[model samples]
Target: MAGGLLRWPVVLCLLNTLIISPVRSTVWTAGSAAMTQGTAVVVGAAAVSSTDEHFVCATLDWWPPEKCDYGTCAWGLASLLNLNLSSHILLNAIKAFSPLKIRLGGSLQDKVIYETEYPQEPCRPFVKNSSEMFGFTEGCLPLSRWDQLNEFFRESGATIIFGLNALNGRVPLSDGSLGGPWDYTNAASLIRYTVNKGYRISGWELGNELSGSGVGARINADQYAEDLMNLDRVVDQTYKGYQFKPLVIGPGGFFDANWFNEFIVKAKSSLDVISHHIYNLGPGVDQNLVEKILNPSYLDGEASTFSNLRDILKSTGASTSAWVGEAGGAYNSGRHLVTNAFVFSFWYLDQLGMSSLYDTKTYCRQSLIGGNYGLLNTTTFKPNPDYYSALLWHRLMGPKVLSTKFNGTKMIRAYAHCARDSKGITLLLLNLDRNSTAQVVVDPGTAQLSAVKYHRGGVKEIKMGEEITREEYHLTAMDGNLHSQTVLLNGKILDLDAQGGIPVLESVKVDALQPINVAALSIVFAHMPSFYAPACV
Candidate 1:
């Protein structure tokens, strides 16, 4: 150990491994022994991944009170139809980011009917029906509700991406698939209405989980392609003379490489983004939820999905973006206590770090506020632990992602990027091991870590005016309880104030010479202002 000790921060996330294959194999390539008991290692940083400026996004689902999973009515008024748009705390949470992307849709998106220009059936709320598709009869979104949502979005300065119903005109067929060309008449009317009203929608997504065998209902790739072309035409015609138009996003479902490649090859350039969903942690009701969160091998399973998606997009030569349309680690509204706890940060932040490496354009969490996976509480509307993690990442991590690799202990995952604001780079070190502490060092391409035994060579003289102190935000579970909804920064509880305002995310300044020590199961966001990176400039 050197004179300055670097205590290991606790960040326990199974990772977005840079490997391939969606299957969860218990084989730990990086050494399971080290995962169980931490190890000393070096993190090398260089290169930059192409990532979008708006890389962080969260979803707002339309699941009504009747929607239940595992015998629990997890959703309580967080739907697009009933969310309290007047929540001041919600407003502040969105505003705290200066600007945050909100994706409005979910499983019921395909079931939604936009009542812009009323016609056929009376526009009404969804009525639960076990005999019908998705366990509910058809639902309607009156233009009045649309108006309210738009107003709230404008007030929050949120970037909006709405999911439109793709099953509108199609007839349900055999094997959970839909048949027929999409009747764009009503949908076009809705889009035109949104345009005429001047509601700023960043993107209008086509459907939800309607690909790769589908979740509720599947659509043929060929037909879906035609539908995408139909959608593009609708968008073009609606924004005919406008200089800027909302983006056309689609096929939000779990990654199915063949389905995606076929859709891409067929859809051609009509698609702006090839979106997908992630529920890699399995059903939310799994008993070993915590074990899965702590296991390195399990987290590594998702890499194949991210890796294959990247390759597919590149191979097709289609100029489109790749976004994780929606991801809630565990499906079925996620585990009540686990998904909503401080421990979920391990999974959430890990996904953020890993997806960026694969050049993911945008990542939309399963929820901003809905179900157990929401960033905010379902009823109280208080911010969750993952909310703070997202906020810190947005505030400190810049769009330019630097290539980072750790040489030891899969228990400790590493990610680096240009600082969100400043003249340097930021490194995020996560320690997943709860019983063991891993000592580690960083290799900044511009300057080497001096006098450390693990230093990989390059050393530069310390400049006089350089910022010698590092700003570190240490995150851990309050009262050492991982299931606690509360979070701590630098050992202080993070709680919002009255009147629904977000609390300041403060960091502690440490001498650059001090040793970087991460304790068991903690998270450290280190902003190295003095460390130089060419990509940042």
Candidate 2:
């Protein structure tokens, strides 16, 4: 037995012995219960809709300016720090999933003041404050800095959705309405400068969390709608003869039923996309982070907001679609290891699958870098577990979302999509069960199953004929440490190559007829090359 173990790779051997040991006996029946009563999931070929590229978007915040001094700041930190947009590693990571959308705004966005004169000192530090939203007083983005940012966006192949300040020296009236017209002078100047410099921004979003009663300050729906129209006029006038007009998106804030309904109804066709933010699990300090992420009911609860927004748009006769402009599992930074670790993939991927079902055109993550929930680490810029998950979703899952039905417990969630630029379907299987392993049988409608099954004890023989090809990329942590940022694909850790290039994704090929053993607390992305899903083509 010891000699036989040496035949396989060290990683595979370790995985078999340490991680997924004690193989359980269970038959996963695909189609009708007559074949076997085991757990099963059927993936349908019918396409729901063309997948939205903006579905996988991220953010570049404008807070805690990267190069701060003591009590003052310049060149908002995210522009100078967090994103090394020019780095080979960063660029390569981004290019791996090209055509990425990045939202450049945050709480400090409303506080930012763009200066045409180049600052003598680019960045200064401000007094450290306990409140996450209070340190923007020192924030300034000079023209030179903006130039650098635009160039970086161009090189990174990113579409910029910039947020303009809404509360710049504005006040509320006696009845708590916007006292005067929004002070768009500072914002307009910056937009005009960006256009003059030939920056290709894709969309212009106004305000940050100023939609519903507001965050720090409130803006009535009527006033906010007027502000949106004013911004629309600014866009039309500024780029009158430009070849491509940027999309006008607005009132970036949380969703309140009445507030959203009124804004959409009043804004009418002025807004291009309805944008909103979500932090479903509350704060990062919550000790029940793991429990919350693993619960299907808890995850599905966010769907109501999406459905409501869609209904609102339809009822209001607005042409815009919904976009989750910003969403992190938790607010105020994030739990150190929980948000960045392999376990976070459960929440992140499920959100992607759920959002796509509700016709959400785009879903931008809270951040690409900075904060504990970033896809990449803030200091080292190393790809977190969620980073690899995002890459795989981009590479394998196509724009066409397909329907899936699983007969097992809700602990094992399933989502299907047409394989990107391929002739088959990709199934994303997430096993959130922390204790017991689950088995799944993929049903390719009406086709006869034929394949060989290899197990630890011996090979389980099955009818064989035409090749039934299947490939899987399983993500899990080493040493059973759910908090560890390190991720293993298949049975190997994904690390940088000797030359610092991104590691290639390792996929394990299997027969479609065999039952797939989904280990506890793991994610499995399966690609079936045989079943030709018409939507993919």
Candidate 3:
């Protein structure tokens, strides 16, 4: 009897282990529950007009180059000494996104004086001791240097939107405002020089932050309008024989409703693009950088500015399209790890998605290589996390914007586009959820299903019969620190080679029939190479 009892217990234990042990892996299924409670992302075939092709652009600061020490430059000691305009690494990276647009303007731009002759000696770098904002000693961009810059841009397929000095030699008015019948002799000479040399410039932006409620010294709207007219005359006169004339854009300042309305009205039709700058998240020193970026509500707040500007342009009957000419989330050179890190993508990518919806024609990121916010590391000239994010966006997202609906928590934000040069759709899914993982199933909607069968809209119950393949390019931090600059794509770290060459993008194949498992606190770009949406083609 005792031997029989022992054998029975052993047998029961084995059965219990077989029945209760966890499965080797858990494949989270997507169903009505996922649609109802988790996240249901539906992408429609209806197409918005082709978005601005040059939507992703970058800027170059006016600060003269200096020695780099651990990615941080001594702003005070910095002179235009170390900037290799044709650095192999820099040009190679820029060429990756060929036909790139780079704006050569910043705070120090207003202080610059264009010297027709090359300086006998390089300008001595000096720091100004002043309480005023952006108070830096004068720097000169010699004609010889400008030629070198033009050659660099031409070779790299970059178009330049050069900012001319508006505050240089301006007369301070009785009202304590900077009044300008601004001096354009130097500027005009430079324009003539550029046109004479046959350098292809896309635009000539007049001033930086001198528009409405200007930086430190305000410029009246009426005065700025006159200045633009002067610059316009110069451009027209200089490019008379040329086939293409560069665009004239200006008033690149923070959007103040009163200031922007007045400037647009005064500038009239002279402006080619209505430009504005936004650093919505305030200064970089704020301690809540992580929280602010992760919060969707904070990210959504920037939309109001976009809407207001568009409305103003429409109300004024201006033909100019709106451009977020300069935006770098937090000002004051940006936070070290926060701006340069992978977490910044949540903010950067969201801006790209949100701005397109509001009809923003072009968005230029501040400081392509100077400040801490640069897409590339200042010292090493290595592509930062945001660089890869921008590259993936440039490679995958097309000009046509598609409508996407996410019926779930705001944690999962989604944007869709027709894949560039391909007969398919691309979806950018950002899982901002701090804890819960999201399983996303792409519903191609009625248009995609009907086209699959009869090559047109007909059946309501049409299904994708075969397994559809998808390529997912995920951008996530290896260890989970949001501020870490180390980014992993499809489970591999992207590092430069011995020759400073960037690695080719790798993707993991996923079946469209299955749910896409989006890990928490990550960004996934799913490319459907098969679903040929009409808008995409």
Candidate 4:
């Protein structure tokens, strides 16, 4: 049986009451709750690694409303053609970060035809065809629709990484391998059109998970390299008169060391970013999904992927950096009440922390607004728990990642980074143990609870002196339900406002010297304004 804090959590659920104050719009005082004191370490001296400025990214897949998985169709009108681009919430969600990276491509991307003027073809939407690959006929992207998308992107202040079809004009071999040169004809025309229209494309990624042991169709490493070089040429030529050319990202697939090492060595300098996908949590419908998420050993299993990729990048001296192109913990569109609920934040936030620790440049979650794993609700365009998590990460955590260690319990996962826009560092603490509360101490050198207080004690607002205070944003599910869509930040409910805008993510101030109190099954973002780190400075 999973244990919980004292009567406070139950009281909140029973009364259906929330504690909110008016001093700060988003701030709330922490009432008494059960918190077991413990010792955890935050190496505040310097940073162990760093990530890209826009480290937090999300994908916008090409799957239409007809896209389904395991007999369930979760994707509504969230496709590019039908998403409410003018939605105030959608605009506010992306604009909240001022600049969120949105990847525009997916499995259907390889089969998509971009409508161009010169070789104008019939521009149509995706039609359900079970016989065709990816369960859809070749879709067409109308130039007019492209204009609308770009307009929405511009208004939302988003960084765009458009994926191109690499298997174009290639015939499928007997073994399901795409063979032949990438006919960059249509792609080049689209690139040319984008350049002429002055679209600010952050990158032009080739293919979708079609590298080693590809997902639908595999491409030879050497052939893929040649195609990448051709892509580089096309990009350079298309943006000849432009001030800057979009980055050429390629071979976005699961990490296969041998294939990656060879591709990196062969495609040297041609590729700007080496990308990979992560579906470590298994399929969406797995019965043990929750159990796997709560298991520390299972969560740490993905470290090898990051570490190995880092090794490949270093050993080969590859000029390109690593990026998790697309990762939705549960693949096949993800599971409902699991991937879309508050519990998933455990996996999502942990991935952000873990990936950054490995020096990953960018980590893009699977769907920005599609499928069951979407950060935003498919119908109302409201922010999900993961959306708030991502937003908080973007607003608080900086690019510089610090070395954080927790020697106490495996149930407590910790990651620290320099504050995004402040002095000091932001520490993300995820408590997977539902039975015991975790009280974290930033530095081992700081005053810690005695051994006697390990299993019993109430959360405190201890006097750390110097009026030094830290900002803490605690995220928990409503009614203590992990499957709840509504989230409470600092004990205040988070939701879209009357104006359909994301609610303010406020924080409560606690004594800087006090040990951070992390509730069970909850996540905490503690910003220590007093702790000075060389990396942060």
What would the per-residue lDDT of candidate 4 be over residues 1-537, giving only the tens digit for each residue?
Answer: 121232221111113344331111223324335556555566555678899998999998888888889999998988877887878889999999889999888888999899998654678889999999889998898898899999999999999999998889898777778889999999998998988897899999999889998988899888899899999999998888878888999888888999888889999898999999999988998989889988999999999999999988989888789999999999899999889999999999999999999889999998887888999989989888999999999989999987777878789998889899898788898999876767676662232333111111112222222245688899988878899998999887898889998888888876454567787898999887666565687
Best by lDDT: 4
> Order the candidates by TM-score, highest first — what do you get?
4, 1, 3, 2
Off by over 4 Å in 1: 1-46, 118-120, 173-176, 445-459, 463-467
User: Which 10 residues in a row give candidate 2 its minimum summed lDDT?
Assistant: 1-10
lDDT (0 to 1) per candidate: 0.80, 0.73, 0.73, 0.83
Question: Please, what are the lDDT tens digits per residue for candidate 2 over residues 1-537?
Answer: 000111121111322353332222222211211221224343343676444764688888865653343332322334432345656766666666787888888777777777754445554433345564454454677676678777777787988899888877577678654546688877888888888878999999988998776776678888788889888989999999988999889788999989989888888878898789988988878899999999999998998987888788777778887888998888777677898898899999999888787778888887788777888777666789998998898888887887666776788888888788776778888888777566676654432223322222112222223334577787878666789999988767888776557799978766554566567788888887665444455
Each prediction's TM-score against the native?
0.89, 0.84, 0.86, 0.90
Candidate 2 off by > 4 Å? 1-45, 65-86, 117-133, 174-179, 444-464, 532-534
lDDT of 4 at 515: 64
lDDT of 1 at 145: 91
Error of 4 at 32 (Å): 9.7
Cα lDDT for residue 255, candidate 1: 88
Model 4, 529: alpha-carbon shift in Å? 0.9
lDDT of residue 179 for candidate 4: 87
Candidate 4 has a TM-score of 0.90
Task: Locate the minimum summed-lDDT window of 10 residues in model 4.
Answer: 451-460
